[model samples]
Target: MVLAFSTESLNGLCSDDQLELLDAIDHLRLQGIDHYISLPQIIVCGDQSSGKSSVLEAISGVPFPVKSNLCTCFPTELVLRRTPETGVTVSIVPDSSYNSTENGLHKFHEELDGFEGFPDLVEKAKVAMGITTLGKAFSKDRLRVEITGPDRPHLTIIDMPGLIHSETKTQSKTDVRLVRQVVRSYMKQPRSIILAVVSAKNDFANQAVLNFAREVDERGSRTMGVITKPDCLVEGSGSEKAFISLARNNQVNFDLGWHVLKNLDSETQKGSSLLNQRNVEEARFFSRGAWKELPPSMLGINELRKRLSDVLLKQIAFELPSLIREIESGLDESREKLKELGEPRRTYDEQRLQLLQVSQGFQSLVEGSVSGSYDDPFFEDAQSDKGYEQRIRSVIQNMNKEFADEITAHGHRREVGSKSQTPDQNPEYVTREVFLDHVQSMMQRTRGQELPGIFSPLVVADLFRQQSSPWEEIARGHVKKAWDSAVKFLELVIEHVADPSISNSLLEKVIRPALKTLLTDAEVKTAELLKSHHRVHPITYNQEYAETIHFPGSHSREEISNIVRSFFGLSSISNGNQYLNNNNYNLSRLVDNLSKRVEPTTERLAASEALDRMLAYYYIALKRFIDGIAIEVIEQKILVPLSDILSPVAVFKMPAKVADLIAGESWESRSKRQDLTKKIDVLREGLGTCERFVSSRLKDEQNSQQEEAAGEDLDTSDLSVGIPTASDTEEAGVV
Candidate 1:
């Protein structure tokens, strides 16, 4: 019952140019290329009753249990290899549902004494595949038939389930979709060369094989049409003319072209041996009649086998590099998935190391954000203008510019003197007239003074108060914007460096509270800074303000005085009037003006000066605040504190159950990791096999070139490189 592969030498399997290439591909498959995807091979396809099984049987020289619908239900992968002795071995790659019953089923491989064993093998396969009930349902699982003999050609062809057009007793509506799906799956592989089988007995247009082939191979570039039962066509009938036209490459011209094979007629099929069928095929079909007129290469199963061997060799050679690239691509993706699954973190020591790595990485990322040295891959392609500190500074700078514009445009004076208007009308608005009235009212209240001309510090203080009341709210807006940016940056760092559970814990336990404290402190300090500047009567003044008042063309003091007076809408005065006004006697005029008619002009000047100083100080203060938030508030409070919170000690102090939860892999991830690991191994093995074959081919080509250069006669009998010789049969193999 045992049909194990005998330990006969298969080294010469690569002796012939065609066999060498085919053996290489077979080796790749044996290395498990299918686990990743489809591999390069010939896929035989046709509709039911299309003589597909006959063509396959002729090519492999094995009786494949050919029948009406029995043998075509499941895919049969025929693996043919040359041997010193003749034998057939059958095995099943069962479906998952049958796995329990077929456990250790490699022992199911059985040696066949004669063609009679095929029918029994077919019944066994049907039963094992769960199609024995009505036996019309199909299976996608492959029943591999390995045949080794002196007569067999070195080949591997997947004979797919025949395309179904209608349902049978055991078939349902779903069977039509299932059969077509299975057939198309093999045909759609770019590496699969389709052998589209069509019966010459049937109308050419009625066969679905050509249509299915065209679905996946639109150009017919890799599709070779095999017209079986050519004897069924009457010699001079319209069918013969049409088939002749097809054979002559006249109708539906395929790139690989059409081939005709004359199989045994129904009467002769029962008693004829495959050897006799192959002999009769050449003797009766190719010797005379319309088939005689066809090119010798386009007739018979032998020629088709030779053509397929050549075409498949070219295909495998062409697709080898691309196949290697695909496998390498898959390998890289698998490795990344394995990386995401990460190292096992079940033990205390493992958890400590894992947490430490996360802490170091997160700390480095946050520090990089502060220093503007972003080397992390996660930070790549982030908005160029949105560096952590740059974002905060940009917001504050924009707000400061808007605040300065608001002060200059509408904060110069107030409308307090108008009885028709009240502060309640626009609580946040102030105009020059209202501001001037307020200043005048304050001056009147403090007028019991040292002298009539003396200016009180209280008036300066009152003016400062009304103008800068809007500062607190504007500053608060800027603070909120900066704080939001800081939180976003922190989250980005954590997400890049740590697991999700660890990130959430750090955000809750360390970063959020620290950010809250720092933000509150920033708000309080901001208000205090603004209030301190308003407490004194112009305690600090920079010459930058006085220097701001010069007119472009002014020269002497008289000219400068005229420019200043004009700017304030004062009446024009000559140089002599300006000289008299420069005397100490002018103090009474100035005091008179400040108390009454010119009070509005005086307030405008004072308000303008106050706005300029406030902006200057704010520009400096905004820079300090951005630096403190990004570097101190966030860096020192939130980001810096995260190190200890995410430290080994903190992770250890956490309940063992919680730590396990944080480090545990999800079921999906674990499954994916194992699956990818298996896939990567399979792909690497396939890649290695193909690489060796390609390298071998290269070496052979180079050797041929060297021989030509040396003027040595090339052996005509050697055939093409990688094509085996008849003499190679001396080396036996069990495939």
Candidate 2:
């Protein structure tokens, strides 16, 4: 499909079916249907000084304002309709974003008797679009000029801002970016058919239209190249060769192919009438030696319209289903947003209900989190990397396990030191000289105060104090970690369940204060629990101590009895007497060996029993402390009080300002809700129309195919009314 014209051309013979479809599409455009659902359309784009305005004037039969210095700064959507009367009107149709600014300024319009007043109207449009100062600026707002004439085609074309290369006094870098953004916005629409106009005078190297078109419409499937000013090419030059190559599709291939339209040159346009411009175009196409051999269908403005109409119809047929889908998707998204915003907040009762709902939801979340149910959505959201492990019950359970392990490990710290064997080899350990030294020190301090073998109460108290010194630090850390986790969980629950309107205030006025109080109370209670353990320095005997101290055999009893008697000097053992009588025995050396070996061993074994008794009782008390804090301090003081205090603060009495905020929607939110509702209606309506159109078109095509297969006459009853068998503008003139 290189589209090289043949000797004979297919001109003025396009089917009435194609023209009818274009007319129906134009009817929808006249109703402003594209604002709701994007329809397949022809959008003309080119660079500055690319003969874009000339081409538009030739195709549209309207004299657009063509300035030598400035390009059109806004999109101009020209909707041409063929009617019995001849008239034109220009109006500004702001985009959806401007719906709230529906003042008279945005709705301004002017009727025109002819093209004589159009240039001034364009200037006015510039000012209305906020380009009041002498600067290069553009707008996304559309200036729609509807022309109803006996000579107009049933077509809609949008003329976008021409791409600029560099900055000048009026146009800065911002203007360059602004133009590209504006043009790309239109070109990027999936349903837009890009009419990329390039001039034959410039080398294709400088033409950016082709590059932009390729960027958005890769493969050039929906882009049609319109080569204007073909007569401007010099004879026998590199530029001439490039123009011919593009026109012949030998370079830069396009699916729709290149179309060479010889519009009236500037000199010719000055003297020629709008009707005579066509005559001039035809004369040049036929008389020019370079273009004379090409097919008439591939030249001139008249054929371009017919070709565009055919292409637009086919495109509409192809994209209708997707357009419906897009519209439906938008509708669904709007509904979801409106749902999240909840029912309109307007009255006191409504506000009260909203607050109550939030409170109830928060309560449910807190309860679920502590109980580990995770039934509520808040906990469900917490099932992620961000401290999901910090759930109330989960954190407490893990901390308790870690605490028990820590305490168990601490009990064996002495045995695992450098001098001792591993616990697996033997669990028995001698506290030995450490306790003996403490008792001796106590005896020296309590001289003349206690009888022999009887420890002063002060000795027991000092030993207990030294052993239990680490409890306060450990208890404080445990309470703080658990409290912090509870507070964090509370914040998460509030954020998840409560509306933004109340979350901040509730946290400030209710949750934070109550949580602080609970933390204070828990800290005090924890200190007291550890203090109680330290206060009762009881040295009472117990069955566990007896079990810890008893030796299992008669040999252990006799050995212990001998060591006590020998060390106490109540008697020398018989073996020692036998060694003393031997001539090899030295009495002083024997005495030194007995004092070093025998006495320390006896004292060590006894000290080990006392140490074992003390630690056994201490370990039991530590286990009780861990359990008591978890139950009484963390759960009872912190977790329970947090929930109880928050309920009263959040549910019972809200501030007057907060009540008003919850009861009523903000102006911005109300505007957004209204806008969405309106757009939803528009989208739904457009979707219905497109659905019906597609259904009818498919049914007609099916019937036509069936009739041909069955050898019967085609049915044309369901199609639109057929137009006159003449040129589109000529048909308009006939009326």
TM-score: which candidate is best?
Answer: 2
Tens-digit lDDT track of model 2 for 170-279? 77888888789878988998888889999887777688888999999988889999888877877667777677778777788889888887766654444224435454
lDDT of 1 by residue, 217-244 (tens): 8888899998888777788899988988
Q: List the residue pairs that clash in candidate 2.
A: 150-732
Error of 1 at 611 (Å): 21
Q: Estimate each model's TM-score.
A: 0.66, 0.68
Candidate 1: which stretches are off by over 4 Å? 1-17, 35-38, 67-70, 81-136, 145-154, 233-236, 264-278, 285-289, 321-355, 367-383, 388-479, 495-664, 716-735
- lDDT of every predicted structure (CA atoms): 0.63, 0.66
Question: What TM-score should be assigned to candidate 2?
Answer: 0.68
> Candidate 1, after superposition: displacement of residue 527 in Å?
12
